[model samples]
Target chain A: MLLQILNIVGIVAFAASGALVGVRKQLDVFGICVVGATTGIGGGILRDLLLGVHPPDSLSKWPNITASVATSLVVFFAHPVLDRIWSAVVLFDALGMGLFAAGGATVALQHGSGALGGVLIGATAAIGGGVIRDMLVNEVPLLLQRDLYALPALLGALLVVVCESIDLPQGISLIAGTAAATGLRCLALWQRWQLPRARVKD
Target chain B: MLLQILNIVGIVAFAASGALVGVRKQLDVFGICVVGATTGIGGGILRDLLLGVHPPDSLSKWPNITASVATSLVVFFAHPVLDRIWSAVVLFDALGMGLFAAGGATVALQHGSGALGGVLIGATAAIGGGVIRDMLVNEVPLLLQRDLYALPALLGALLVVVCESIDLPQGISLIAGTAAATGLRCLALWQRWQLPRARVKD
Candidate 1:
């Protein structure tokens, strides 16, 4: 039940980001839909493909696709109203990051991926959508920039793994991961947190 | 030798098309390179992935990548000059279609794909680069248009498949396939060929 909720939130957040990027890029309705769909599902597609899961969930699952498309349309027609609810957008995105992070690690674990592999997969799943979104929009990936972006997902996945090792309930681990990721992302945004940059050589 | 030559020619042609689209989209040098690279190699990547081939050839075969990047740089600096060489571009592109069609079919057959699958793969391999390029530029895929974009590759694959059934030499079959595809493409271009469009219900 919790996973399902998080999945919906992630789809909505991803679609919203995709629509915003499409609007910023001055793309039309079709373009907006493409970006939204790609952003919402790109990471999971990559993960599933790498795991040798044929067709991928994004293609096989109707609800995920519907959610992505619906979110894009909503954003397309009502971005001004949605923009007024910026906190809601951030909250949705943070929820998505945590959900994807946990989902990725869980899937990788099911595939018999090692702890390190799970961590990597979780991180990839969390950020893969955003990377594809930025690429489609012809912008440098937000992942390449150092912020709270990938780190939050990493910590969330790590927490999930740790809790699993100690025999904690999966639901609790998932919720804890979501909360950690959300809090970190909110803090990062509020504080304008950035990673240290390398000094220019003379 | 001929397949290798065709591959190089196809990569260059696709690269040129990618560069042209990038120019139209007002992308920077990096963006142009991305478009060129994806256009030159995206189909092969998809094919390899579906075939469960790890890392994909484009990642491991640096020469093919070099060909794409070099072609992109050339197009970037010499757009004006290359624009005047339209006939040469078309001719090279035709040769590329012929070569890649055969190559895609051969690879699929090696992987035990059925005759129909081989044909589909061949057609996809031939036009995949252009499809990706169009998507990246936020345009509808050129292959989906009324142009005879995918037909030459289909014919080429058909010839190869027919020859294989008749116990013909592989070399001869490849040559025959290339000739068929090239002739069809050239004829289509000369005749200003187009597929019939559906009537719109107003």
Candidate 2:
């Protein structure tokens, strides 16, 4: 039940962020909806594809579509107000990343992916949607350049793999993984932490 | 046997186009390879996922990866020469678009998709890889703004769906579908056929 709620929250957050980008890009209604829907579910779909799960659970289940569409509509109408609460939006995004990273790792492990594959899939699931959303707006994906974006998800996924390998209970492992990711993301935001760039003289 | 050869040609053409774009974008070798590989196989992967075929054949089979990587390397080293043959690249790209469109429609039908679904999936299979490649390079997807790009793919897919619905022979249907798409694409290139744009005063 908790997991389901987390998933819903993640979908909503991702959809809202996508819709926000769509609005900023001055996209039409159809374009906004497309961006929102893809951002909400694209990562999970990609993860499932990589893990050999067909037709992705996001498409098979109605709730995810509902949540994404509803969030898109809400953001479309209330973007002016939503834009003011940028910090809150970032918090929600971080939460979503944490939940998705943990969820992805768990799913990959269940599908018999090795630990390395699980971590890669988990990070992909956490960040892929945003990457797609950015690309749709003709922007460089934040995952490639943003400080501390992919790292938290990778660490969180690694934690999950380690916990599972040690036979830790699923619930505890999930909690630990989520906390690790969310906390790190929040800290990075607050501290203005950034990853070092290559010192190549371009 | 013919279809297999067509698929290989499509893969090589897509990979070469992606590598060309990577070079133009001044990306590193790794980035070039990544873009090339994705452009070659991303569409098929997407199509299979939608059709509920897990572990897409592109990943399971070695030939696809080998072909893409080899093309990427060739393009990376010989870009100066390749750039001079822009017309040939365009011709190859058109051929790939037509073949993949027909192939995607056939696969979707075999997987029991309705006609509309088959057309949608087919167009996706033909164009999704290029979209991903363009996005990775931070460019607007050519499918969205380019003249007469997607229409041919849609038409080819529709032709395949219609042929199957009318109980046409598989060989005849495939040839007709491919011809419809390829011929139209070639004509568009030769005659500068373009879709009408919205008359918005920008």
Q: Which candidate number maximizes TM-score?
A: 2
Best candidate (score: DockQ): 2
Looking at model 1, residue A123 earns an lDDT score of 75
- Please provide, for model 2 over B163-186, each residue's C-alpha lDDT reduced to its tens digit, 9 standing for 90 to 100: 999999877777888889878888
Fold similarity of candidate 2's chain A to the true chain A, as a TM-score: 0.91
Q: How close is candidate 1 to the true structure, as a TM-score?
A: 0.61
Quote the positional error of residue A99 for candidate 2 in Å: 1.2
Give the runs in model 1 whose Cα sits over 4 Å from its true position: A1-5, A84-91, A144-146, B1-16, B19-38, B50-202
**DockQ (0 to 1) for model 2:** 0.16
DockQ (Cα-based) for each candidate? 0.08, 0.16
lDDT, candidate 1, A41-154, per-residue tens? 777777777677644566445677788989877876766555434454455566667778887776777687878877888778888888777665555777775478889989
**Superposition error at A32 for model 2 (Å):** 1.7
